[model samples]
Target: TEGLVMAKNSSAADQLELIALAVRGNVSLALAARAVRSAVEAGEYEAIARALADQAGRNDPLQPRDRALAATVAAELSRLGSKAAPLWQVAREAWELERSAWWLAYALFREAEALLSAAGKRDAARDVLVRARSIARLLEAAPLLAEIDALAGRGRVDLGSPSPQLLDPVPDRKLPISDREMEVLVLIAKGLTNKEIASELFISERTAAHHVGHIFDKLGVSNRVEAASVAHQAGVLVEDT
Candidate 1:
């Protein structure tokens, strides 16, 4: 217990030290923003937000980019609380700050999905799915396109009528990537991080990063949560990690 406490304290100190270094301009604000975004993408949203808040609390005049990042993080926190209107608005504002096309496509897809579902509009959902399919195809993201196709195929479409299928159990063999990519997808669906994937695959972290990049491109997702959702829809999620 004593050793564990010391370790925890050391970890906290390290984080604080890193934050201080960042504030002192020892690192680019973009690097700090990337770290925060990575934390959020890894589903560590609270940590990301808290870190941002801590930096902001230091009463420093953050670079314009960092200020924008802070605003985005605040918006994400609001979104987590189920405020639909504000959430969507903030999501768009934040989307403009990043240059990653994959990220923007993923965000737009999310917005379309939200709009479709929120208005009880199944027909619109189908349309959005079709558009998402087109975008994924244009990006040469075949695996993601297949996943979208599967979604479109799973439900009946008749004048916005709704008969939702059981999403947790579907055909697992319909994965759209190569076998190796599928293996990574299954692990991702099981909620494994890239580090964990590297350890499991006995590969270097760089190799694992490469696989994850390919998976995201092929899967048409910019983050793991979306990939996991699609995997669940396709019945790729297994009982264990």
Candidate 2:
């Protein structure tokens, strides 16, 4: 898969190509954006951001989906480059132009780390994040929903409606870690952040962070990168847990 390939270290040119695809409104804009962010130099991001803004400007009145993608591309590009604050504002207007669920949620779902890491931009992140999460709910994209919830970190976000059937059954077992905690650990070992783990488990970010702290205490590892290596070495995240 292109996503799996992007997950591994790839050349800057390959990542830039992905960015180009995303800028041109390709379906995997989130994955491509992430690949570019991870692989390309910071200086290159501005050029890509400009390309996204330009692509977003070419709205096709006949294709609502393409119009939606234009907005999504504008929104997705906000996560990159030093000019994010202004791009984020542009993205917000684009978001307001459409109300229904679309690929924008997919793009915003990938914005978790970047948005949350932006410090002073929490206000900006929140305004757009609310729309993104709502759209995710309408789309019934559970993983995307969870990612939004966990990253929101407020723990009180109204998830719109419950869809218990869509979620994996909460496993039950006896071990140093609860089944839920174990599940979090497995996701962690799989390179999911606490936010992504929370999304995957349909839990709160605060809860996810707490579970991770406990997992670290139990496993005697200090950080998630270390936790992944240690868990693999000890077979702690084995299947059929």
**RMSD, each candidate, Å?**
18.3, 13.4
Best by lDDT: 2
Scored by Cα lDDT, where does model 1 land? 0.55
Put down candidate 2 lDDT per residue, 80-154, tens digits, no spaces. 545455555555455446644455565554443345455465555666677788787788898787767765643
Error of 1 at 99 (Å): 4.1
Each prediction's whole-model lDDT (CA): 0.55, 0.59
TM-score of predicted structure 1? 0.33
Error of 2 at 4 (Å): 42
Report the Cα lDDT for candidate 2: 0.59
Cα-based TM-score, every candidate: 0.33, 0.42
Clashing pairs in 2: 146-199
Residue 123 displacement (Å), model 2 = 6.5
Q: Judge candidate 2 at residue 177 and give its lDDT.
A: 69
